[model samples]
Target: MPAATRHLARRFGASQIALNTKMTIETIYIARHVDIYASSAGYRMNWVTDDWQSVTGLPRDPPLAEYGLSQAQELADYFLSLPEEERPTIMLSSPYYRCLQTAVPTAQKLGLPLYVEHGLSEWYSPVAPGTGLHPRPASAAELRTYFPEIDESWQSIYYPSRKGEDVEQVHDRANGFLRALIPYIEHKFGGKHKRVLLVSHAATVIALTHELIGDRNLPLRVGCCTLTELQRKPGETELIGAWERKRLADGSHLKDGATREWGLEDIIVINDTGLPGTENAADSPVGLQVDLLPPEVLAHV
Candidate 1:
């Protein structure tokens, strides 16, 4: 066993003798990919316009724009600022160029292996038949060449396509990803809190939240570089499956408390989506509040 696993095993042995049961607390953090912009084509709804053929007339997989790269750098800094133990031990990212780009700086800074997961890719949108608006991700070989640190040992199950997935499918995909972690969690750090970081698209992360909590009552839409955390114990009953929501679509860490810097902007507003202020207008400036609720409130949810 590796040094870290050996240490965890020794600790787990002692804890097992005292408690006589596995605790298996694993914390998962999901972050949405940061800002991306069109090269020559204009964007729509924050994504590169699907009909690039009409505008730029060039096939493109949009990478992070300059602003997006800055946001990602800020995000990396946020994670770097955390205590060593508080940072994630493992990092998984969507195979998309943008998601991989988002994870690259953090992986480089933290010395963590980056895993490309196809299930974490952006929600696909099926275009009209023969319109050729269907977007596809770059090949793994291309990604590997670009991101030399990526773990090429793992195989991706998602193939690039224009077909879009519904909310339920996204939820199922998230569940699959989560469920597959149980064995690794048990073996790597039994009964200890090990943070796993996932860099994915907005819809996939939101669906993950729903899967973990069994509720669609998310506080707001997930935005670029937003972070949400959830925790649970392995082999625990679903009835007592507790999770904590630390942050929701928050980029405040990018700016000083008093002044918004780092090119922070409120592009999407959360309202009438069963959040606390349902009556608030969709364009309300107050924007989506991160759920920094007390532990008791999180436990109840």
Candidate 2:
């Protein structure tokens, strides 16, 4: 280990050093944003009503519901209960209000600087007719006003298209972030054994999981405040090692487990499969949701 790494290990403790030496593992924890006050028809309006657009002045970006706030607190308590060595060393969140709101408590508890990463921003779809363009998310500087812990010094790895991103574009954005982020972490933190927590939307969580595991066929479960863990051992070359899905979208910490869960079918449609009452839907290839990136794209990581 380098001098900086040795210092970090010593600061953390001897046990952490031993653990790092034994496994040399790095971890990424991807968390989906908690539920928001949505405007869906027939859904109960707790904080906002049907005219939520005129009420909040934010049609697309809604704040977390009352229940979601409690869930965020629970998440923080869960992190506090973990051993120091197992806790996250760095935290990143999407610029969206919901994601930032979900991450704030944990960031405060961990004493980790919250960095706004556009690469991990919510998946953007094309504008619908008569619906106008989707409102752009708050910038890092703007987010700082609400989240004082936000570290504005760090630059984002990638930014999504202004118009919107298709499914493949979203997948590519996630891949690009992974490729750039690993090297940046190695350089900034000066160690292989690092734990990073990313708070983002359901689509982004699924996309990030796909990129990390290098598998698009797996059925991903994304729920409000759910955590999906990705892990990899240190490699000989400069390239980061291939990643494995250590944990699916797990929301065991929450008192009410896995609320407002979203699946592959929610984001992508495949021959009307995976729909309710579809024949043999459980075994259908709808599980093969996202298309794998090109071989060259995977090689860069």
Candidate 3:
């Protein structure tokens, strides 16, 4: 019944996003950004916030670590190895350096358009500085300078406050984001562009799964750079279930078994300009900033 209503809306023009006339999306990939953990304290990882600030000389948004970049490249390699129709038609990222960076390799390899989405940003926390559960994002201008491929006029739909949004709020936001975005994808590029890739944070990705699977806080765990697949066929009301959960794909291309874990003692101090404590903690600027494109991608760019 619910699936029927969704299809009816797609068939007719009753929804805000008009359908793409003849398109049907076979798969959707929602992923968490590659690793950003640089140093850890008690309960949280510092997100290596200052490392990117020093590198770009921009605002304080955490960038990908050396390992993280390789993970993204691996992901690009995975996608590139896939059949043409399987690649993402459009790519989107959270309004964070890590997520944006994760998208860079694939976006470049595929020559796909990348958009920054505010709703996809990491969970916010107004809690004190010491806690590791929250994130502070870079401004749009700063991000634009680094990632010129992003549409210039794009604005964030999710606005964060000093005290970050809680679990329920994030869950609700993820639900709303998918509800609006799925229809838009079907309407905008139904036939030609059916696959959509979203690079986001851990909590946000989990929330999205909750919304799609109709479960609250499902125990699904997403590793860094993990890819989760969901399918919405033509007349299905809540995404085909039973077999759907059984079919969810996570981190299939990832060859690395264990992710990098950091401790405070391993941290380095790059310089005064670097984040206060994380001086040389992550890879040098040479590695972090450079994108060593694969041979095939060089032809396009």
Best by lDDT: 2
For 142-233, candidate 2 gives per-residue lDDT tens digits of 77877898998876656665445677777777876777566555544556537888899888888888877777666887878888887774
Question: How much does candidate 2 score in TM-score?
Answer: 0.73
Candidate 1 regions exceeding 4 Å error are: 1-25, 36-60, 126-139, 157-162, 182-193, 233-242, 256-301
Native-referenced Cα lDDT, model 3: 0.59
Q: Candidate 2: give the clashing pairs.
A: none
TM-score of each: 0.63, 0.73, 0.66
Off by over 4 Å in 3: 1-23, 36-60, 126-142, 153-162, 188-192, 237-243, 246-249, 258-301
lDDT order of candidates, top first: 2, 3, 1
Task: Choose 2 or 3, whichever is better by lDDT.
Answer: 2
What's the lDDT for all of these models? 0.57, 0.67, 0.59
lDDT of 3 by residue, 1-301 (tens): 2453454456544443232334355677887878734321111123544323434543445456666777788899988999997788788888777788889889889987678877687764334343322334566677778887776454443443323555666676776566545544454443456677888877777777767777764566666777877766456644313114423336667766324332122323221122344322432221111132221111111
Span of ten consecutive residues with least summed lDDT in model 1: 256-265
On TM-score, who's better, 1 or 3? Answer: 3
Worst lDDT window (10 residues) for model 3? 286-295
What are the per-residue Cα lDDT tens digits for candidate 1 across 135-213?
4455456578778979876555333334344455555556655543433344444445467888987777776777766
